[model samples]
Target: MLNRMSDHRLAQLNIAALKAPLDDPALADFVALLDPINALAEASPGFVWRYVDENGADATAARPFGDDLIVNFSLWADRDSLWNFTYRSGHLDLLRRRREWFTRMAAAHQVMWWVPAGRIPTIEEAGERLALLRANGPSPEAFTFTDSYPPPSAPPTTAETGTPETATRAGAGLTPPRPASPSSS
Candidate 1:
Protein backbone atom coordinates (compact mmCIF):
# COMPACT_ATOMS: atom_id res chain seq x y z
CA MET A 1 0.00 0.00 0.00
CA LEU A 2 3.06 2.22 0.04
CA ASN A 3 2.73 4.45 -3.08
CA ARG A 4 6.42 5.49 -3.14
CA MET A 5 6.26 9.17 -4.00
CA SER A 6 9.33 11.38 -3.89
CA ASP A 7 10.05 13.71 -0.96
CA HIS A 8 9.51 16.61 -3.33
CA ARG A 9 6.09 15.31 -4.28
CA LEU A 10 5.23 14.67 -0.67
CA ALA A 11 6.19 18.27 0.08
CA GLN A 12 3.53 19.45 -2.37
CA LEU A 13 0.79 17.29 -0.87
CA ASN A 14 -1.68 18.90 1.59
CA ILE A 15 -3.50 16.77 4.17
CA ALA A 16 -5.59 17.62 7.24
CA ALA A 17 -9.07 17.01 8.75
CA LEU A 18 -11.57 17.79 11.49
CA LYS A 19 -12.32 15.26 14.20
CA ALA A 20 -16.06 15.89 14.67
CA PRO A 21 -19.13 15.70 12.49
CA LEU A 22 -21.29 18.80 12.39
CA ASP A 23 -24.41 17.07 11.21
CA ASP A 24 -25.84 13.56 11.50
CA PRO A 25 -28.78 13.78 9.16
CA ALA A 26 -27.98 10.96 6.76
CA LEU A 27 -24.29 11.87 7.31
CA ALA A 28 -24.11 13.80 4.03
CA ASP A 29 -24.33 17.11 5.85
CA PHE A 30 -21.12 16.30 7.69
CA VAL A 31 -19.38 15.98 4.38
CA ALA A 32 -20.95 19.28 3.39
CA LEU A 33 -19.28 20.94 6.39
CA LEU A 34 -16.00 19.44 5.30
CA ASP A 35 -16.38 20.25 1.59
CA PRO A 36 -15.08 23.83 1.68
CA ILE A 37 -12.19 23.06 4.05
CA ASN A 38 -11.15 20.02 2.07
CA ALA A 39 -10.96 22.22 -0.99
CA LEU A 40 -9.01 24.82 0.91
CA ALA A 41 -6.56 22.25 2.30
CA GLU A 42 -6.11 20.76 -1.17
CA ALA A 43 -5.20 24.23 -2.33
CA SER A 44 -2.79 24.86 0.53
CA PRO A 45 0.94 24.28 0.37
CA GLY A 46 2.25 20.79 1.26
CA PHE A 47 -1.14 19.19 0.65
CA VAL A 48 -1.01 15.56 -0.41
CA TRP A 49 -3.92 13.11 -0.07
CA ARG A 50 -6.73 12.66 2.40
CA TYR A 51 -8.55 9.51 3.53
CA VAL A 52 -12.11 10.13 2.42
CA ASP A 53 -15.30 8.20 3.12
CA GLU A 54 -17.92 9.09 0.56
CA ASN A 55 -20.48 6.96 2.36
CA GLY A 56 -18.41 3.89 1.32
CA ALA A 57 -17.83 5.11 -2.25
CA ASP A 58 -14.18 6.02 -1.53
CA ALA A 59 -11.41 3.47 -1.52
CA THR A 60 -9.99 4.18 1.97
CA ALA A 61 -12.65 4.03 4.65
CA ALA A 62 -12.74 6.18 7.84
CA ARG A 63 -16.15 4.92 8.90
CA PRO A 64 -16.10 4.27 12.64
CA PHE A 65 -16.93 0.71 13.62
CA GLY A 66 -18.63 2.08 16.72
CA ASP A 67 -21.37 4.69 17.01
CA ASP A 68 -19.46 7.40 18.88
CA LEU A 69 -16.14 7.41 17.05
CA ILE A 70 -14.94 9.18 13.92
CA VAL A 71 -11.55 9.02 12.25
CA ASN A 72 -9.84 11.08 9.59
CA PHE A 73 -6.50 10.17 8.02
CA SER A 74 -4.18 11.94 5.60
CA LEU A 75 -0.54 12.61 4.80
CA TRP A 76 1.57 15.75 4.58
CA ALA A 77 5.10 16.72 3.58
CA ASP A 78 6.22 17.60 7.10
CA ARG A 79 5.10 18.66 10.56
CA ASP A 80 5.42 22.42 10.01
CA SER A 81 2.82 22.62 7.29
CA LEU A 82 0.46 20.40 9.24
CA TRP A 83 0.97 22.47 12.37
CA ASN A 84 0.36 25.71 10.55
CA PHE A 85 -2.84 24.52 8.96
CA THR A 86 -4.08 22.82 12.09
CA TYR A 87 -3.35 25.59 14.58
CA ARG A 88 -2.51 28.76 12.61
CA SER A 89 -4.50 28.68 9.39
CA GLY A 90 -8.20 28.91 8.70
CA HIS A 91 -8.60 25.31 9.76
CA LEU A 92 -7.60 26.35 13.25
CA ASP A 93 -10.77 28.41 13.49
CA LEU A 94 -12.84 25.37 12.73
CA LEU A 95 -10.93 23.37 15.29
CA ARG A 96 -11.51 26.02 17.91
CA ARG A 97 -15.22 25.40 17.65
CA ARG A 98 -15.06 21.61 17.43
CA ARG A 99 -17.35 21.14 20.45
CA GLU A 100 -20.14 22.61 18.38
CA TRP A 101 -19.63 19.93 15.76
CA PHE A 102 -18.00 16.71 16.97
CA THR A 103 -18.83 14.20 19.66
CA ARG A 104 -16.38 14.21 22.52
CA MET A 105 -14.24 11.11 22.41
CA ALA A 106 -12.53 9.40 25.33
CA ALA A 107 -9.82 7.85 23.20
CA ALA A 108 -7.04 9.30 21.16
CA HIS A 109 -8.79 11.72 18.80
CA GLN A 110 -6.06 12.60 16.31
CA VAL A 111 -2.65 11.21 15.48
CA MET A 112 0.14 11.38 12.89
CA TRP A 113 2.56 8.78 11.61
CA TRP A 114 5.01 8.55 8.74
CA VAL A 115 4.18 6.11 5.99
CA PRO A 116 6.98 4.74 3.80
CA ALA A 117 7.43 7.84 1.64
CA GLY A 118 4.16 7.34 -0.27
CA ARG A 119 2.30 4.55 1.42
CA ILE A 120 -1.30 5.22 2.39
CA PRO A 121 -2.07 3.43 5.65
CA THR A 122 -5.41 1.63 5.67
CA ILE A 123 -8.02 2.83 8.17
CA GLU A 124 -8.14 -0.48 9.97
CA GLU A 125 -4.37 -0.39 10.14
CA ALA A 126 -4.41 3.13 11.45
CA GLY A 127 -7.08 2.28 13.99
CA GLU A 128 -5.12 -0.65 15.30
CA ARG A 129 -1.98 1.43 15.42
CA LEU A 130 -3.78 4.01 17.49
CA ALA A 131 -4.99 1.33 19.83
CA LEU A 132 -1.47 0.09 20.25
CA LEU A 133 -0.29 3.53 21.28
CA ARG A 134 -3.18 4.00 23.66
CA ALA A 135 -2.59 0.65 25.29
CA ASN A 136 1.20 0.64 25.28
CA GLY A 137 3.40 3.40 23.97
CA PRO A 138 4.98 4.77 20.78
CA SER A 139 7.31 2.84 18.60
CA PRO A 140 7.60 3.01 14.81
CA GLU A 141 3.90 2.46 14.27
CA ALA A 142 2.24 4.61 16.92
CA PHE A 143 2.87 7.80 18.96
CA THR A 144 1.40 10.99 20.35
CA PHE A 145 2.36 14.58 21.24
CA THR A 146 3.48 13.72 24.75
CA ASP A 147 5.73 11.11 23.14
CA SER A 148 6.38 11.79 19.48
CA TYR A 149 8.32 9.30 17.35
CA PRO A 150 10.06 10.59 14.28
CA PRO A 151 9.64 8.44 11.20
CA PRO A 152 12.02 5.56 10.92
CA SER A 153 15.42 6.42 9.49
CA ALA A 154 15.40 3.31 7.34
CA PRO A 155 12.64 0.99 6.18
CA PRO A 156 12.51 -2.22 8.18
CA THR A 157 14.93 -4.90 7.03
CA THR A 158 14.07 -8.57 7.11
CA ALA A 159 16.64 -11.03 8.46
CA GLU A 160 15.30 -14.33 7.16
CA THR A 161 14.96 -13.64 3.42
CA GLY A 162 17.53 -10.82 3.35
CA THR A 163 14.89 -8.63 1.69
CA PRO A 164 12.36 -6.10 2.92
CA GLU A 165 8.65 -6.65 3.08
CA THR A 166 5.85 -4.14 3.27
CA ALA A 167 5.66 -3.26 6.94
CA THR A 168 3.34 -5.80 8.48
CA ARG A 169 0.07 -4.37 9.82
CA ALA A 170 -0.91 -7.46 11.78
CA GLY A 171 1.06 -6.71 14.99
CA ALA A 172 4.53 -7.62 13.78
CA GLY A 173 7.16 -5.37 15.43
CA LEU A 174 4.36 -3.89 17.47
CA THR A 175 4.93 -2.85 21.05
CA PRO A 176 4.06 -5.46 23.61
CA PRO A 177 0.68 -5.04 25.21
CA ARG A 178 0.65 -3.30 28.56
CA PRO A 179 0.11 -5.33 31.67
CA ALA A 180 -3.15 -4.72 33.45
CA SER A 181 -3.12 -2.04 36.13
CA PRO A 182 -2.42 -3.77 39.39
CA SER A 183 -5.01 -3.63 42.11
CA SER A 184 -4.11 -1.24 44.92
CA SER A 185 -1.65 -2.92 47.24
Candidate 2:
Protein backbone atom coordinates (compact mmCIF):
# COMPACT_ATOMS: atom_id res chain seq x y z
CA MET A 1 0.00 0.00 0.00
CA LEU A 2 1.12 3.58 -0.62
CA ASN A 3 1.46 4.54 3.01
CA ARG A 4 2.93 7.96 2.40
CA MET A 5 0.65 10.92 3.09
CA SER A 6 0.39 13.59 0.44
CA ASP A 7 0.02 16.49 2.85
CA HIS A 8 3.03 15.59 4.97
CA ARG A 9 6.66 14.77 4.35
CA LEU A 10 8.55 11.87 5.92
CA ALA A 11 11.16 12.57 8.58
CA GLN A 12 13.69 9.89 9.41
CA LEU A 13 16.45 9.37 11.95
CA ASN A 14 19.10 6.65 11.70
CA ILE A 15 21.58 6.18 14.50
CA ALA A 16 24.63 3.97 14.50
CA ALA A 17 27.14 3.35 17.25
CA LEU A 18 30.71 3.54 16.03
CA LYS A 19 33.12 0.69 16.53
CA ALA A 20 35.99 3.13 16.15
CA PRO A 21 36.51 6.84 15.58
CA LEU A 22 36.18 8.17 12.05
CA ASP A 23 39.90 8.80 11.81
CA ASP A 24 40.79 5.28 12.85
CA PRO A 25 42.35 3.21 10.10
CA ALA A 26 39.71 0.50 10.65
CA LEU A 27 36.97 3.03 9.84
CA ALA A 28 38.72 4.87 7.00
CA ASP A 29 36.79 3.13 4.26
CA PHE A 30 33.46 3.88 5.91
CA VAL A 31 34.47 7.46 6.49
CA ALA A 32 35.62 7.83 2.92
CA LEU A 33 32.30 6.57 1.60
CA LEU A 34 30.11 8.93 3.61
CA ASP A 35 30.42 11.87 1.25
CA PRO A 36 29.48 9.89 -1.81
CA ILE A 37 26.52 8.26 -0.13
CA ASN A 38 25.29 11.61 1.17
CA ALA A 39 25.67 13.16 -2.24
CA LEU A 40 23.58 10.38 -3.73
CA ALA A 41 20.82 11.04 -1.24
CA GLU A 42 20.81 14.74 -2.08
CA ALA A 43 20.53 13.95 -5.80
CA SER A 44 17.77 11.41 -5.32
CA PRO A 45 14.23 12.26 -6.19
CA GLY A 46 11.93 13.60 -3.49
CA PHE A 47 14.74 14.41 -1.05
CA VAL A 48 13.77 17.51 0.89
CA TRP A 49 16.24 18.37 3.65
CA ARG A 50 19.03 16.85 5.73
CA TYR A 51 20.34 17.87 9.11
CA VAL A 52 23.97 18.89 9.09
CA ASP A 53 26.45 20.09 11.64
CA GLU A 54 27.27 23.78 12.05
CA ASN A 55 30.02 23.35 9.49
CA GLY A 56 27.49 21.83 7.06
CA ALA A 57 29.29 18.52 6.90
CA ASP A 58 27.64 15.10 7.22
CA ALA A 59 25.68 14.33 10.38
CA THR A 60 28.29 11.91 11.75
CA ALA A 61 29.54 14.50 14.18
CA ALA A 62 26.09 15.32 15.56
CA ARG A 63 26.01 12.54 18.12
CA PRO A 64 22.93 12.69 20.25
CA PHE A 65 23.69 9.39 21.99
CA GLY A 66 27.10 10.56 23.22
CA ASP A 67 30.37 10.57 21.31
CA ASP A 68 30.06 7.05 19.97
CA LEU A 69 26.70 7.20 18.22
CA ILE A 70 25.99 9.16 15.05
CA VAL A 71 22.78 10.43 13.52
CA ASN A 72 21.44 10.85 10.04
CA PHE A 73 18.30 12.97 10.23
CA SER A 74 16.58 13.98 7.06
CA LEU A 75 13.27 14.65 5.38
CA TRP A 76 11.94 13.23 2.15
CA ALA A 77 8.92 13.91 0.00
CA ASP A 78 7.51 10.61 1.26
CA ARG A 79 8.40 7.07 2.29
CA ASP A 80 8.89 5.88 -1.26
CA SER A 81 11.52 8.52 -1.87
CA LEU A 82 13.61 7.45 1.13
CA TRP A 83 13.08 3.72 0.44
CA ASN A 84 14.35 4.15 -3.09
CA PHE A 85 17.47 6.02 -2.03
CA THR A 86 18.38 3.80 0.89
CA TYR A 87 17.71 0.45 -0.78
CA ARG A 88 17.68 0.92 -4.54
CA SER A 89 20.39 3.48 -5.21
CA GLY A 90 24.16 3.00 -5.34
CA HIS A 91 24.33 3.56 -1.60
CA LEU A 92 23.03 0.02 -0.93
CA ASP A 93 26.51 -1.53 -0.99
CA LEU A 94 27.85 1.03 1.42
CA LEU A 95 24.90 0.47 3.71
CA ARG A 96 25.57 -3.25 3.80
CA ARG A 97 29.14 -2.53 4.82
CA ARG A 98 27.92 -0.82 7.99
CA ARG A 99 28.61 -3.89 10.08
CA GLU A 100 32.33 -3.27 9.61
CA TRP A 101 32.30 0.19 11.16
CA PHE A 102 29.29 0.30 13.47
CA THR A 103 28.27 -1.65 16.52
CA ARG A 104 24.90 -3.35 16.80
CA MET A 105 22.40 -1.23 18.68
CA ALA A 106 20.43 -3.02 21.41
CA ALA A 107 17.07 -1.56 20.43
CA ALA A 108 15.74 0.05 17.29
CA HIS A 109 18.22 2.48 15.75
CA GLN A 110 15.93 4.10 13.24
CA VAL A 111 12.61 5.88 13.58
CA MET A 112 10.39 7.63 11.08
CA TRP A 113 7.35 9.87 11.26
CA TRP A 114 5.29 12.16 9.12
CA VAL A 115 5.63 15.90 9.59
CA PRO A 116 4.08 18.97 8.04
CA ALA A 117 5.86 20.00 4.87
CA GLY A 118 8.84 22.38 5.31
CA ARG A 119 8.98 21.71 9.03
CA ILE A 120 12.35 20.80 10.50
CA PRO A 121 12.25 18.49 13.50
CA THR A 122 14.60 19.24 16.36
CA ILE A 123 17.02 16.58 17.57
CA GLU A 124 15.24 16.45 20.90
CA GLU A 125 11.94 15.73 19.16
CA ALA A 126 13.58 12.95 17.17
CA GLY A 127 15.18 11.55 20.32
CA GLU A 128 11.75 11.33 21.92
CA ARG A 129 10.43 9.46 18.91
CA LEU A 130 13.34 7.04 19.07
CA ALA A 131 12.72 6.45 22.76
CA LEU A 132 9.04 5.87 22.04
CA LEU A 133 9.91 3.25 19.42
CA ARG A 134 12.29 1.44 21.76
CA ALA A 135 9.76 1.41 24.55
CA ASN A 136 6.55 0.75 22.59
CA GLY A 137 7.60 -0.76 19.25
CA PRO A 138 5.95 0.27 16.00
CA SER A 139 3.26 2.81 16.67
CA PRO A 140 1.83 5.45 14.39
CA GLU A 141 3.69 8.07 16.42
CA ALA A 142 7.06 6.55 15.71
CA PHE A 143 7.80 3.63 13.38
CA THR A 144 10.28 1.81 11.17
CA PHE A 145 10.51 1.29 7.44
CA THR A 146 9.57 -2.39 7.62
CA ASP A 147 6.50 -1.35 9.61
CA SER A 148 5.42 2.08 8.49
CA TYR A 149 2.42 4.24 9.29
CA PRO A 150 0.32 6.53 7.17
CA PRO A 151 0.15 10.26 7.89
CA PRO A 152 -2.62 11.84 9.96
CA SER A 153 -4.00 13.35 6.77
CA ALA A 154 -5.07 9.95 5.44
CA PRO A 155 -8.80 9.59 4.80
CA PRO A 156 -10.43 8.38 8.02
CA THR A 157 -12.02 5.27 6.52
CA THR A 158 -8.79 4.02 4.94
CA ALA A 159 -6.69 4.53 8.09
CA GLU A 160 -8.38 1.51 9.66
CA THR A 161 -9.77 -1.79 8.38
CA GLY A 162 -13.45 -1.35 7.65
CA THR A 163 -15.88 -1.57 4.78
CA PRO A 164 -16.62 1.88 3.40
CA GLU A 165 -20.08 3.11 4.29
CA THR A 166 -22.01 6.23 3.33
CA ALA A 167 -24.00 7.34 6.35
CA THR A 168 -27.29 9.16 5.85
CA ARG A 169 -28.61 11.84 8.16
CA ALA A 170 -30.93 9.23 9.67
CA GLY A 171 -28.06 6.79 10.25
CA ALA A 172 -26.00 9.49 11.89
CA GLY A 173 -28.99 10.51 14.09
CA LEU A 174 -29.02 14.17 13.09
CA THR A 175 -32.57 15.00 12.06
CA PRO A 176 -33.05 17.92 9.69
CA PRO A 177 -34.90 20.84 11.25
CA ARG A 178 -38.63 20.70 10.37
CA PRO A 179 -39.47 23.16 7.60
CA ALA A 180 -41.90 25.86 8.75
CA SER A 181 -45.10 25.87 6.64
CA PRO A 182 -45.51 29.61 7.14
CA SER A 183 -44.57 32.22 9.75
CA SER A 184 -47.52 32.77 12.18
CA SER A 185 -48.86 36.31 11.90
Candidate 1 overall lDDT versus native:
0.55
TM-score (all chains, Cα) for each model: 0.61, 0.79
Per-candidate clash tally:
7, 0
Indicate the worst ten consecutive residues by lDDT in candidate 1.
8-17
Report the error of model 1 at residue 152, Å: 1.6
Off by over 4 Å in 1: 1-32, 53-62, 155-185
Measured over all alpha carbons after superposition, the RMSD of each candidate to the real structure, in angstroms, is 13.4, 7.3
Q: lDDT per model, in order?
A: 0.55, 0.83
RMSD of 1: 13.4
| lDDT by residue for model 1 (76-115), tens | 7666666666677778776776655565666665556677
What are the per-residue Cα lDDT tens digits for candidate 2 across 39-98? 899999999988886776668877767898889999999899999999999889988898
Evaluate candidate 2 by giving its C-alpha RMSD to the native, one decimal: 7.3
Clash pairs for candidate 1: 2-119, 13-46, 13-47, 13-48, 14-46, 14-47, 14-48
